[model samples]
Target chain A: MDSSPPYLSILGVFALLSVLAVGGGAAVLPETKALTVTHFHWLADDEFRDIYGLGQLSPGPNMLMVIAIGYWVAGYPGAALAFFGFFLPSSFICFGASRLWNRFEGSQWRLAIQRGMAPIVVGLMAAGTVSVARVAIEGWITAALALAVFGILLARKINPAYLVAVGGVVGYFFLV
Target chain B: MSEAAPAPTAPAAPAGPVPLREIFLTFLLIGATSFGGGVVAYLRNSLVRAKKWLDEDQFLEALEISQTLPGLNATNMSVIVGDRLRGPWGSVAAFLGMTLPGAAMMTALGVMYALHKDHAVVSSVLVGVGAAAVGLLASVTIQVGRKQLEHVLDLSIVAATVLMISVFHISMPIVLLVLGPIAVFIYRPHPKRIHLRRRHHGHDIKPAD
Candidate 1:
């Protein structure tokens, strides 16, 4: 069994995702899940959900879960590649685009583009939510938890981290 | 402690070169301490309120640019604000600062997860967390899309996009390439509309007759 891990492909997948993450990491969740779970078979759907949960528990961008997928596929080197692949291209584009954007300050076309992209970004976010829901929502308890969290967030100003933690405790008692 | 609560009526920050190290440290603090996903609030508090590196208008301007771009808003803001402060290397420092802490922590957690993948308690807790995360994402999407969701054209576009991706399983590139231009064209600047809108904005206010 020759098991050296497919380094180039891991890099390729994440790099593609990086560029396509218009509107942010959440916007590309379905694509990310598709590439990793279906195309590459790098992680199972359940595992993908679990890794995403780990990301939520952490303090920074929840998309840092990509590193876990990389690690699972090709160990530490893969982790490094996924991080670079996922961040660099998009960051580089943003850097250059921002410079150009400043030149067109107050341009009508700029407003047009922002207005147009807004709805599309929302749509993409909706799809991302569905992708997670497919794997994460098992039954009524999970469904109820999701609803409660959604309602609380809409109605109040509490930090979401607290809700996520409370979810874990609830799961500890109920799910297990 | 007092530094944390700098007087609200302090004078404007001096318009001088900020040290690259300070930019890095500021972003580093933001990256490490900003729990949950809303780094925007932490950023506004630090840059606008505490450090006074940018005024409210400047911060919002940076935020608009960040939101419009393709990367994470927190990282994009770091880059734009960092560049505004001290050019390209400033961007590097800020990007590194914004991502490093989370990357390190996530990597550690990844290792821990690998070691204990089959533990029943760990698995159950993760299940709950994932479900809650979905809720978080739903709330965020609603808030962000609230404006778009109200208008018919925007709502239709939003609906169409979800249908293509979630139902048809269309790849992202195809969706962007096809819909992106169409959406842009729909809202493309019309000369008459621009002229009328510009007049309303105090662009060419007339004297009282």
Candidate 2:
């Protein structure tokens, strides 16, 4: 682990993922999991699952797991470097793009591009959902919980924080 | 009597620049408290409700644009809001304010990981958190799907992507590369007319031929 240059790799992987991570960072979950768990073997499947859990529970973006991954690989330096490398490129890209986007704000072609993007983004997100479920739902109870959450979300307007809190309490007693 | 006649006017507060320190602190607070998967909702609550910095429609527009872009929606939203509030420097401030805490926390966890590689309590907490995360991810999927997926073609693409990735174990980059072009070609809309529906409307329009 010490010699693996895991921090460097984390930066590289996240930079790549950031570019392709359209529709939110969820779109990159499958790739990130595969690279971190399956390809690199830096983290076990369960560990990857746990890190992802932390990312979800923590404030801010769920993709903040990159920092956790970096930290796990190296140390504080790794975390700091990974955070800087991963976020800076994407932040600059977005900032510049936003400025340009405003210029074409009224273009029908721009509207068309956005329309075309909707399905692709949705498709990517759906893929991400499956990727997460496949890893997290190991048993019947967990699977049932996943489905229940899905149903609850689809049917009503429950705030997501409440759902996470309830799931945490239930899982602490039952699954843990 | 002279003092009463002079009834000194209260010193006019110096109208200086909004303190960057205050802005950074506010951003940090928003980042720390924005938990449980509702980044957008938490952002609204913090920025609009708590700080009163942005109005509802402004926040919504920023959210819409953020979702359309490639990055974390919350981060992207922060960039937009930061840019609006304090220009480019403010954007950097917001980005740092948002990410610093998570980075520090994760780094601490990493240190703990080095020492306690096989601790049961750590494992158990992670297990519990992992289970809860599944629920969170599922909820997000359904919520985003309802709002974004309207057309049957959109739903079909979603189903296909899920099946391809989950069942076939296809690489995501390849999936995106393959599907991206197809989506662009198939879903691209034909050029349409742009008309000013009302005079004096502030709709930013390109020069008409």
Candidate 3:
């Protein structure tokens, strides 16, 4: 492993990710993959892929990749810094904005802004889905599983956690 | 046009604020147990279903708003819901609630990752988890798409986007730049109908629940 001061690098990467992470953290995935795998050479492509998988399986935000990357780089402290850097700025901005939002609660502009934002958000989220699928869905088995999960979610109304659990069992037997 | 409207019955005073302490603890629990990439579902269960803090419509509206804003949808929604419930302070409370625990857990996992970078058990578990995560992402896409993509235009946008990104390997940022503005322009509400509807309904517009 490249033995630099990884904690600092982790902090810097996460802070940058926080600001540029428009739409959602997933929007930054391709760049993250490139930097970690192709440029920095800190993690191999497969390792980067695995960390992303863990981020997806674990809860909270898929941006949890910061923590995994931090771990790969430095140790617990790197993880701490990565989490703080990734989360704090956005938290502060939203906290401050909430105050301003209340002042204009009744304004027509607020409604219009909300109306305008809805579709854009949906579009960005769709983009995020594409980014993840491109990296993760490699084989016919994986593709079939993805389709099955999608059908179960949209058509069957099954809770998603259960689908993940079932997929884990199947994967252990088949894919793993 | 300038007629004095009857004084609106005092809009129900905004409910007394939820204590910041409760918000913090609630989010902490959410952060800790939010395994398997079900943060939204977890929030829906905890806040909307269990706590009854936000009615379904309110929760849905917040979800919509969070989706539009930049950030994690769950974290953004938590801040919005908290802010609506209390004030700016509530946004902090909700944000910390949702994030701190998960951050701590992941950070610890990072330590383990460094130590056991080549362990067989770790590798095996990751293999299983990674495959499952693929399933989870697929599930989320379907759920969100069904709820949000009502118009044919919206569906078309999603299909085109999926094709461009998945098949053609277009970069995400480029796809976003190209598609984001087009969605906004195409989906802009019909102005004439909005004005007519506003006039017919009078000024006593019901606040979104």
**Chain A TM-scores in order:** 0.95, 0.91, 0.80
Please write out the lDDT profile of model 2 over residues B1-209, one tens digit for every residue: 03335434332221344466756777787788776656666677677766656776666667657766777877787787778777898788888788777666666666675577567655555565666666667666666566555568777777777777777888877877777666666655553323321121222211111
* Candidate 1 local lDDT, B107-195, one digit each (tens): 98899899998899999999999889889999988977864444688888998899999999999899999899998898789876565
Residue-level lDDT of model 1, residues A17-88, one tens digit each, is: 988888897898989998999888888888999999998887778887888888878889999999999988
**Candidate 2: clashing pairs of residues:** none
DockQ of each: 0.75, 0.59, 0.40
Stretches off by above 4 angstroms in model 2 are A1-4, B1-17, B50-52, B191-209
Q: Ten-residue segment with the worst summed lDDT in candidate 2 chain B?
A: B200-209
Candidate 3 structure quality by residue, lDDT tens digits, A9-94: 77776776665555566555655665566556777755775677666555577687788787776666766787777777666665
Tens-digit lDDT track of model 2 for A104-128: 7666555555555666676666667
Per-prediction TM-score? 0.92, 0.84, 0.75
The DockQ value obtained for model 2 is 0.59
- Output the better candidate (1/3) by lDDT: 1
Q: Give the TM-score ranking, best first.
A: 1, 2, 3
iRMSD of prediction 1 = 1.2
